[model samples]
Target: MPDARGSSGRPRRGDRKLSGDRAGAALKVLQITDLHLRDDARPLIGVNTEATLIEVLDQAFASFTPDVVLATGDIAHDATLPTYLRFLQIIEQYHHGPKLCVPGNHDLIGPMIAARLPIDPLRVGNWVFVGLDSHVDDEVGSQVSDRDIAELVAACPPIGEKRHTLVATHHPPLEVNCPWLDKDRIQNASDLLESLARQTTVKGLVFGHAHQAVEGQSNGIGLFGTPSTCFQFEPESERFAIGDEQPGYRWLHLYDDGRIDSAVERVACSFEIDLTQRD
Candidate 1:
């Protein structure tokens, strides 16, 4: 198990070290979300989500070979143990680097709590990764506990440092422009943002649950949402509905100089679906 520190005494993304003579190395990251996998092994919305996720990860590995893989949340559909186990198995298979995950509304929080999987912030390389449990069991809405917020603030790197930080959660902290989805967004988001606004080391925030790609800035920090590997939500729509947009993931390239570049790439598949088709 390789750590973030390399042999050259400089910080590396994972266990591998950068060449001593190289000026700096970029931190490559792959973000996948909203798997919504089921225990019965059934497809959702006419798409085989499990298979789609597997294929998407394969493509991501071949193309990006990311140093770290982040799964924002909603890894399971019904919050079942088997579902989480299945999700974990797939992650272990395709991920060659350090992997960090946060839970979504569809996940079983009780199981996570019982297992004691360290629901705290993690620091890797020059970045701090904060995972929040936003699921309010049996509810459609999300909430960020005060404890989680304090932990997030405490985990932030020192101010004026060149390190980057990313906060991860299942629900978007801001409105997604869709009335239905916005209503279920993270409660106390204003508080969260207020806390984040006070931090100078915070570089960006990443989340899932929207099932669509969205990018914006909050308090001078970049906020991005990754598309789902299962189904996509209709963006900027007035109604609650799904869309024909291809499933995809987000790729993030973090330069050592504290600059970040990212994009959303749709998975290439042999088949395409007309989602508007009536049964």
Candidate 2:
């Protein structure tokens, strides 16, 4: 296991060392979201999401083998136990690094807890990764709970060797300019941002479910929404629309000095997409 240590190389408590990653090196994290894996043999929006996930995983492992992997949300499209179990299995086989996940509106939390799936912050080296559950049951829009931020502030301080933190949720706090999708975003984002502003240790936030890539910053903190590993939604569109872009994942490099470098990488394979479908 590789743990981030202080300048003196002393390990901190409550932090798990990442396996297969070297100490003192920039922590490599891979973010895959909106897998929408289903137990049945059905293509989502005219695309085989499971097959696309495999292709994206293949590229992720081949191009950037990360020390930690974060699955943001919508892991299971049908919200069934079997789908969740299969997702657990796939995540186990997809990456050898540490795994942390949060549920989306499509993912039922009760079943996930019943199955004993992992849902907690992953502390690796100098940074702590907090997984926030912003999913509103039976609702399209989501909001963050103030408690999640409080727990993060208590667990990881904003200064000293543990000054860096990254927050991952299933929903983006800000709108991505797409009117159809923007209506279903985190409605109470200012609360989350206010908390982050007070706790300056949190350097950035990442999310899934938008099906588009958005990179921006607010109050000196970075904000990002990653593309799905399956089908993508049209960006900046006023109505629901399908996109022609390929599936992809986010590659993040977390430096020990509180810097986060990230980008979206699409799979290099052809997909059977139905661009006409819009919802």
Candidate 3:
């Protein structure tokens, strides 16, 4: 594994050695997914999506400040510019670091592009976070085009490079055991994993859309699935089911030694999620 230390033996981010205690400090990344924010303040099920997101953010920041805020997907339920902007506005109030995102089944590329929410690969600390577009038009399932695979390969640091890479997309590349959601896993997930295996610097993969917490290991890389900011889906279910769990988010501590520690935190406030109401 390629660690973040440079030739001078100091932790680095892309050739720049970090200064003082910061050099050894872990890069905190807060992962919030499946926001499903709508143009109007409509509640999904019995939970107000926007309000729950605010609560999630407030809870997230109250515990720890992150170096980056990773919004995995489904940023806007309506796929409108106004919705995206509103989402950005809410995020800006809590996080001033890099706001990164990838589109989901419910998201529109044009509106997200217009909102200027970056999907580009970003280097922070010793890790390079790469965002991929797995969304397929007019479908609930996901796939990574060959072009994106090629681009992902291109974005990875070469063999001798010190930085590790983490890939983020809307759809899970691995199954989370929820049959309904698993059907929407990346169609060519094998191809993606194969590509990642070829890259020596790639360390982990993170995604959303499961609407539940997931942790797994595939091809020696870490796999993380975060809970939704609003409602969560029942895990390991054969069909679609809403969970009673509160809205939550994931936090990743990326260290300079190519190690990652993460945990999921839910809001203290309880929102009555109507489990019977499926939408």
Candidate 4:
């Protein structure tokens, strides 16, 4: 790893802020996905979605200061207008930076659009973040149209000049190995992949909907799936079941040189869950 030391051979000021300096010069990013927020009276699989979202945000506020915040999707549980507004209000409480978003199967796009929530390609600290809505009608599966793909490609700047690119979506572009969950994986991932292939600057793909923390790669591009702020799903299971994990979020430190450091932070609280009831 190149040292964070100045050309004079002395350690830089922010060098002491990070441990060992492997992070180099990077953007500290906080990502909270799959909020699944609903009314105060309603709960998703025995967990109060709205309350848990607050808990997760509260924790992130104390621990991280992201140059950008990505709310990947499923922001609304009931797909109601109020839920979307509430989600926006809660997010605005702490995050003042770029808030990028994409819609999941449970999200109602029209209402979100009308509310003026963030959903644009954001450029920050030499990196461009592109959001793709994978919400497909009548099917839990998502599709990326050729037009969507073209827009994503067109929005990307020259790889070396722009630093890097990160693509955000609501659906996992590849199978997660959980049979039940895999069925809802992006049905037209080929469109996404083909689009990504055209943009060589892409360094990361962050998504939600699996409701679990997952890390892997697709054709050497870094792939990440974040856990929900509400609950989690068991990974690699044949059937749908609630995971034992508590509410959590993922954080990323994106370096200007196309290198990224990421991790999953499990919340300090564990609420009672009725695992027998499947979502």
TM, every model: 0.83, 0.86, 0.88, 0.87
In candidate 2, list every pair of residues with a backbone clash.
4-125
lDDT of 3 by residue, 129-233 (tens): 988888965568887888889888788876578888888889988667778988898878777777787765777788899888776656767777888998888
What is residue 59's positional error in candidate 3, in angstroms? 0.8
Q: Which ranges in model 2 have alpha carbons more than 4 Å from their true place?
A: 1-24, 274-279
Model 1, residue 77: distance off in Å is 0.5
Tens-digit lDDT track for model 2 on 142-229? Answer: 8666776677567655655555888888887777777788787877677667677676588888898888887666666677788899
Q: What is the lDDT of residue 84 in candidate 3?
A: 94
Deviation of model 2 at 107, angstroms: 0.8
Q: lDDT of each prediction vs. the true structure?
A: 0.72, 0.76, 0.80, 0.77
Q: Candidate 1 — which residues are off by over 4 angstroms?
A: 1-24, 113-120, 270-279
TM-score of 4: 0.87
Sort the candidates on TM-score, descending order: 3, 4, 2, 1
Which 10 consecutive residues of model 4 have the lowest summed lDDT?
Answer: 9-18
lDDT of 3 at 146: 85
Q: Where is the poorest 10-residue window by lDDT in model 3? A: 10-19
**Residue 172 displacement (Å), model 3:** 0.9
Worst 10 residues of 2 by lDDT: 9-18
lDDT by residue (tens digit), candidate 4, 1-279: 112234554322210123454544778877788887875566667788778888888887798677889988888777777878888888888887788988898888888888788998898978889898888644587777788878878887754565688889998877776889878787767656655755658888888998887766655567778889988887668897878777888888898778878888877555678655434
Clashing pairs in 1: none
